[model samples]
Target: MKASAFMYGLITGSVTAAVTILYSTPQSGSEIRSSIKNASTDMKHKLYDVKGKISDLKDSITHMTKEVKELVPEAVHDIKGSIEQWQLSTEKNKLRLEKEISAIQTSLAELEQTIAAQQK
Candidate 1:
């Protein structure tokens, strides 16, 4: 008897819940279906647009990497040539400065000798 009572209560509760759901819904079944379909279509278009943008980005990155690989070697070669040229130019100036310093030392020595002779 207790089991039969429990079963009856369950059925009654299920039927009342169904009727409440059917009457309380704001949109009809057809309108809900249409809205869902439109939403799915919009989502697909957005996904395709995102996919195209990613492909374009990948292509641009690949092109830039290729350009950097080509330019790096050329830039390094130019820098090496510039350094060698600078060293060559400075070598001539260094020799001339050394000669000038030696000449100045000799002149000072001769002046000191003349002053000592005059004192004597």
Candidate 2:
């Protein structure tokens, strides 16, 4: 049973015990019957209130679950797009660096050839 239901049961039991003890001391049959009936009505109302609260809580949970479900896929898609863009930019930078390195290598080889001719 739910915590709320268990707590309500305990409250109801205590109340019933108190009423029974009080009435048992010295009360007419008609008065006892009337008290019992009032207790019954009060119990019914308490039960109804608990049921309504439970229903509201269930609806709130369902709405929150749906919102989370809807947001998760969109969040994942955005992250994936960002990763792809970052990868593309990184590849472009790598290519540019390679070209710069190749140019430097060629210039070093030409300078070596010029030095050799000067030595001759």
**Which portions of model 1 show Cα errors greater than 4 Å?**
1-25, 98-120
Best by TM-score: 1
Which lDDT tens digits does candidate 2 get at residues 1-120?
899999999999999998888767687778877988999999999999999999999999999999999999999999999999999989989999999999999999999999999999
Best by lDDT: 2
Assess the local accuracy of residue 74 in candidate 1 as a C-alpha lDDT between 0 and 100.
Answer: 100
Clashing pairs in 1: none
Give the runs in model 2 whose Cα sits over 4 Å from its true position: 1-23, 87-120
Clashes of each: 0, 0
